[model samples]
Target: MSRPNCEDFRHLFVNDTPLMDMRAPVEFTQGAFPTSHSRPLMTDDERAAVGTCYKNKGQDAAIDLGHKLVNGDVKAERVAQWKAFCEANPDGYLYCFRGGLRSQITQQWLKEAGIDYPFITGGYKALRRYLVDTIDEVAAKPMSIVAGNTGSGKTIMVNVLANGLDLEGAAHHRGSSFGRYVTPQRTQIAFESDLAVQMVKKLDRGIEHFVFEDEGKNIGCVTVPLSINRAMQEADIAVIDDPVDVRLARLLDDYVVKMQRDYVAHYGEEQGWILFAEYLEKGMFNIRKRLGLERYEVMLKSQQHAVKMMQSNGSLTEHDAWLAPLLEQYYDPMYTYQLSKKADRIVFRGDYHQVQDWLAAR
Candidate 1:
């Protein structure tokens, strides 16, 4: 039977085909095709058991055990559901680990049931490999750059243009001292894999307009791929500007000084007081230097303080007034000095609204 071409499979299996990833739920949770609807044919535990069998029992014996272990009633139930889904969607595709054992077995059952479902070529493994290899292709191409001072909303614009990968957003944390987030971060391998996947997806879309947030090689503790880092250099920078008060308000809302309640309740007495003092003076680097688990407790206090002030006061106005003077006299000058040397045009901006509107267009 004729099979779908690569582009067709991509279109159908991803955008068009009803996608079924047969990996266990645990594997699916780790990652799956963007469009895949997981109906784990086997649980993770079951898959592990089967894998152990294959490892120790050899092929024939393992295959025999696998068949036996998949009790007839359970197999029938899974196959029936799969058959129904495929029959319901004429252009459906199913995939499994390496397209070796699980996918082949599923395909055989589909055929035996007189269903015309297709499997991914080489299964999810091949599809992932295709994405992995294409990452180099994307990295080699030129990308447009977005550069600005911190809180420039460059990453937000990156998503608006939907071009370059939003590693910062994907990680669900900002890329700064204030960026320390409440969420659990990814493992290095997982982050890299996810980053590559996003890059490949953008390339596949044939997007010429590559937009990326200006960032150092590392965002917090996560390092961007070297390939992506090099790719960023080719892009032009778009500087975003916001009013001092507006920026301060944003800073306060987004970043809390009192990450802990003690930051205020204990006020100036806690270790975070030193961090707060350093923040009022130096900024992020100093806080990082003194950071430890206990310090984080005090940091929480800072967040609490920032939050209290923010809620009681408006985001950019009343709440940020206290910081406004410091920002204008200190941070603004430092930012201006850095921006002047960016080697890129202002391209757009005199005010916060203007910058916001322009960045919105990006």
Candidate 2:
């Protein structure tokens, strides 16, 4: 009845375990289990102190100091909070760095209180290992993919599925420079760990259907697994076509300023504003080249006042002008063409509800 093993992680996930992370506040903030609401047993400073103690003073001293820090009253407080959480989620699980002493201490406290729960064996390290191993295993098996051009909502649909990998979301980062809204770009290892977690979930659901945003080897900084990429290349694809205007609107709305906010806020008001002014007249045309004339014109008009304000103060760099057009007119289009050439071609095409139903029925 206890949620402990990797084989049961999906059950814990479905049951909505609190995912009590005992690692430390900092790591939790970076990235951890996607569905888990984390409550760190050790504060950032406390964990760091123990780590320093372990390295400098040796294991015995570290344990003594850790004991000194984690006194009975404080321990009781942790048990109380976790007890309350577990009361609500009887299936909740706890993990510490490497699933070691910290988690052991916490679990012992639970047992002393007569709470018989099994903690994740081997901790986050094991979970991380499971993620890597499982992703590789799943990749060797077949998977179906949904591929499309930029703004195809392919990434969005992946998350909506009853089960699947949301690579862009998994990374807590999107695949584009402009797509780092929900969380800052993750460390390379962290991104991969997160992705592997999703892969395991998808494969375990008895699901071979994979929906991937047609990404290059690198999405900003994170590199997706080659196996998953290979599967994507081989799977049947369907272009999630939206009108150029509609796609264009989504592109700007997702990236550019909102509520007519100064375009500079997209970067930063002061510095980004200055850049917009200095480069926009010349640069604006270049952007138009990629975003397309109509959409580009719309954003330019919207950003015009901000452009003027900055120009009155200073100038934006125009250095990217030459390459921007190349990326816009030639490279981007070519990339799409290659994706079309590579994929098995459209298998299904509809809006998400339609597509979701298609996936649901299957």
Candidate 3:
């Protein structure tokens, strides 16, 4: 019996289908789908050898080298791994860089092992193209920008909306100097793949109008796709106009309280506290030039005192000393200037609930 080739890329992504990536480890590390697991047919060295043979001799010679390299116990071991993955993810499909020789050989081996499995028709390249197209297609729809000063709960508001696209969430950074999480952000390729998959899933649910947080091109290390960024620039803006105290409290919770808790959770109490302090200090140091030498010095001193106080008494309130000034002196003015440039695009300006309601109604 002949095994079928899976070509419904949207179905695979929408359902979060398990994918067995047969590319070399180096290729998988560069980029892969969220559901993809790297189970390469050739090691990087083996692939390099075969590639050289293909260039110097030809495809037939390359094939001979690949067989010789991955034969005997090696071949049986790989087949066993594939069989286990197939049994575990009965609905999963396998693919290589292209729907070419590597995947075909794997499928044939699986068949010989008495387990027939399908491969993606166009493989990794095609799947990536599908996701890219999804982003462009969804970005063409109507969109709304959630714009506000730092810590105005814009991200929170975005999460509350049905049509909202949390770009920062996809990028895994909070979109600020203090936004780096305890965990590292995704690779640029992975970030784009994630964002594109999100668009696909959201659009599948019939969400035509997308709500996105106001952001520049870069969100920490990852970039918003140019198509989506352009749409955001042209989209209507909904400003979350919370009081200064409210914004400050929100920021304190997010940056200091929760961030500390995250570090502690990840690294245990002692080391977590040290790393937490270093994280904040590094954030401050990163913006020293922009904050001005004198002001930065003052703020850094306050921040250091706040960290010590928190370490001693578990008092998070002391963070407000530097955080308040950071917002008032640095973030507020900068955001206010940025907002002014997009003033013409402002469609609704209200506190969190009102903005939430406005976005929901849209």
Candidate 4:
């Protein structure tokens, strides 16, 4: 049977197929495709040793040493793992850094052992370059920006649209100091890869235009790619204008109730509550400079009282005390000022359902 080499980039990512990454774990941890899993051909130290041998004694000597280092049970075990994965995910592809020596060895061994699987032609590097280039191409198309005040459910609006790129979701952040999620953030490279994947998927669907929430250059530690960020800045804008009460309720549901539950799910109850309280207070404290000394003190006092109320009353209403002022005194004015600068970009301004309907019809 002829071995299949290389994979169609769009199909691999759009379908969310399995990928067996044959690079060392150290390399895989830094970044990888979304659905890919690490199944390294050699241990990091082994790869290192082989590299040293290649530099010292050349390719043939390095190959012999690599074989020697991974022979017998080690080789058998690695092949067995690949075989099992192939059996379970028959369409899955294997890849190495350059799709050269390591992946060739893996395919040959798997073939000898009565298993045959394809590897991406240019491997991880090629696929990554394809994705990077794809993003630049896709970002050149027209797009829209979903602009809203804090707690205005702008994320929900953008996410509900089939064609929207949820930048905050891609970055695993809500795009605010208080927006940390229970999950660890993606590495910067991983973030860019994921964002590109999202754009490519949209492109595959024949989507020429996409929507994104208005975001700064950075989302948490990960920055939006320059081309895409420029597109977002220049895109037509839709504003979500939910009432303060509604926005506050949404914010509490997202930041407090949901966040607390996520914390509890990840940590135990006691520890989760402690962390929840800590994060809540820290989020408020983080904006101290912007909030000013007197306003910050008031907000802090209100926040401390709200925490006490949560512990004693098990009610979220106390949070509204601080949240309302925080929005009015801080977030509302701040967002309004920012929105003013982009007034010419505004295409539609309405409540949540209205924005959703407009996007759906588009």
Query: How many pairs of residues in model 4 come into backbone collision?
Result: 1
Q: Better model by lDDT, 2 or 4?
A: 4
Task: Name the candidate, 2 or 4, with the larger TM-score value.
Answer: 4
Poorest stretch of ten by lDDT in candidate 2: 315-324
CA lDDT, every model vs. true structure? 0.63, 0.63, 0.91, 0.88
Alpha-carbon RMSD of each model:
7.5, 7.0, 2.2, 2.2
Alpha carbon lDDT of residue 66, candidate 2? 80
Candidate 3 residue pairs that clash = none
Estimate TM-scores for all models: 0.68, 0.67, 0.95, 0.93
Candidate 2, residues 217-250: lDDT per residue as tens digits? 7776677778777767666655565544445445
Q: Which stretches of candidate 1 lie over 4 Å from their true place?
A: 1-3, 6-18, 80-90, 112-114, 162-165, 177-205, 220-222, 233-236, 249-362
Single out the weakest 10-residue window by summed lDDT for candidate 1. Answer: 314-323
Q: Which runs of model 4 end up more than 4 angstroms from their true locations?
A: 1-5
Question: What is the TM-score (0 to 1) of candidate 3?
Answer: 0.95
Greater-TM-score candidate between 2 and 3: 3
Best by TM-score: 3
